[model samples]
Target: MEHRIRLAGPAEAAPELACLRVIARLPSHWSVEILECGTGYAILGLRTRVPAEEAVARIDEAIAVLPLLGWRRD
Candidate 1:
């Protein structure tokens, strides 16, 4: 299954850096990538075979710390 999260922030190197940060927080079995980046938002694509609820929980947990890195959900 695939899930997407939109992070609102500067569109510069911040997006790539944020992607790395998120990747570090997720389980190794999951695949993550940047799907789109705009002036003030970035879309991250997460792919995993985990159940929907578990996936959402893991994603939320990973992103919960994003604010400290200067990002917020969009």
Candidate 2:
């Protein structure tokens, strides 16, 4: 499953990038792609063998704790 998450602001780029880097370095069931979109960045999240909703929930849980990286899911 893959999800494209739109960030709330450009200020989130640094912390989000840092967090994604850490996630990439660890053993995981998922992969994330960060791309610059004008002033902000977008995240493309992919998880194999997981339901689409579950993958989204996992990403939501990860982003919820971040002060600035959270975005509106709707």
Candidate 3:
């Protein structure tokens, strides 16, 4: 399933994003940075898992779309 990721720009928003839940089947996930509350905006990245046979194609689609999800780890 495709997951939608949203950014929380405030410290208060952290709890919501920091504690985001995902299905167990999805790969391990975590944020590069725990953005300071009420300080900066966070960029979020999202993609759905696909079967090996379909991965390449889906990757292309993911690439075509803006990686609204954050690309940097640091």
Candidate 4:
């Protein structure tokens, strides 16, 4: 299955850089990639074999720390 997280409003960095930073903080076991990026938002694609609900929960938990980095879900 594939899940997506949209990160927006990167404070001092380009969208790609901000996404990279977020990816770096996520668990290495996760299969994550940058799907799309623009001036203020980046879309991260996560590919996993887990169930849908669990995948959502995992992604949510992973992104919980994004607010501290000046990014918010869009």
Candidate 5:
């Protein structure tokens, strides 16, 4: 098997950038927890020979931040 790597700037990452925005205007007193929010990035820094447990933990953490997982717009 083989793989390829690609790089992109914020503009290329978001075509019609303004249209794809998801705003989470949380209240002042409540907690502000969101995954795809500003400057709150999740880096799954997995090396070539890392342990499964470590990778799983990192992935879980990233998944936990996603607010749309249990949400529906229908």
Candidate 6:
């Protein structure tokens, strides 16, 4: 199954990219894709055999620490 998190605008992309990089390296049985949705929007695609809720929880955990990395949405 695949789950995606769509983030709008360039403002969120940098940190999201950074965070997602870590997510991509995490110990998971999932595959991650970074997709450019448009001029300013992006998508974080997660393909996993895990449950949907588990994927969401992992994504949420990554987002939760985003601010600590010095990136915040404008």
Clashing pairs in 4: none
True-vs-predicted CA distance for residue 57, candidate 1, Å = 2.6
Quality of model 5 by C-alpha lDDT: 0.27
Residue 44 in candidate 3, Cα distance off native in Å: 1.4
Our tally of clashes for model 6 stands at 0
Q: Rate the local accuracy (lDDT) of all candidates.
A: 0.73, 0.52, 0.33, 0.73, 0.27, 0.58
Residue-by-residue lDDT tens digits, candidate 4, 1-74: 87887878755658887777777766688799999998778899988777767765655565577443566766
- Report residue 46 deviation for candidate 3 (angstroms): 1.7
Spell out the clash pairs found in candidate 3: 10-38, 11-37, 11-38, 44-69, 44-70, 45-69, 45-70
Q: Which 10 consecutive positions of candidate 5 have the poorest summed lDDT?
A: 1-10
Give a tens-digit lDDT track for model 3, residues 1-74. 33333333334333324323211223455222223323333433444454443433432333233322332122
Candidate 1: segments with Cα more than 4 A from true spot: 10-13, 66-69
lDDT of 1: 0.73
Q: Per-residue CA lDDT of candidate 1, range 3-74, in tens?
A: 887877655546666667777888998888889876767788888998767866765676678443556666
Assess the local accuracy of residue 28 in candidate 2 as a C-alpha lDDT between 0 and 100. 74
Ranked by lDDT, the better of candidates 1 and 3 is 1
Clash count in backbone of candidate 5: 0
On the 0 to 100 scale, the lDDT of residue 15 in model 2 is: 43
Most accurate candidate by TM-score: 1
- lDDT score, candidate 4: 0.73
lDDT of 6 at 64: 49
My TM-score estimates for the predictions, one after another, are 0.71, 0.54, 0.22, 0.69, 0.27, 0.59
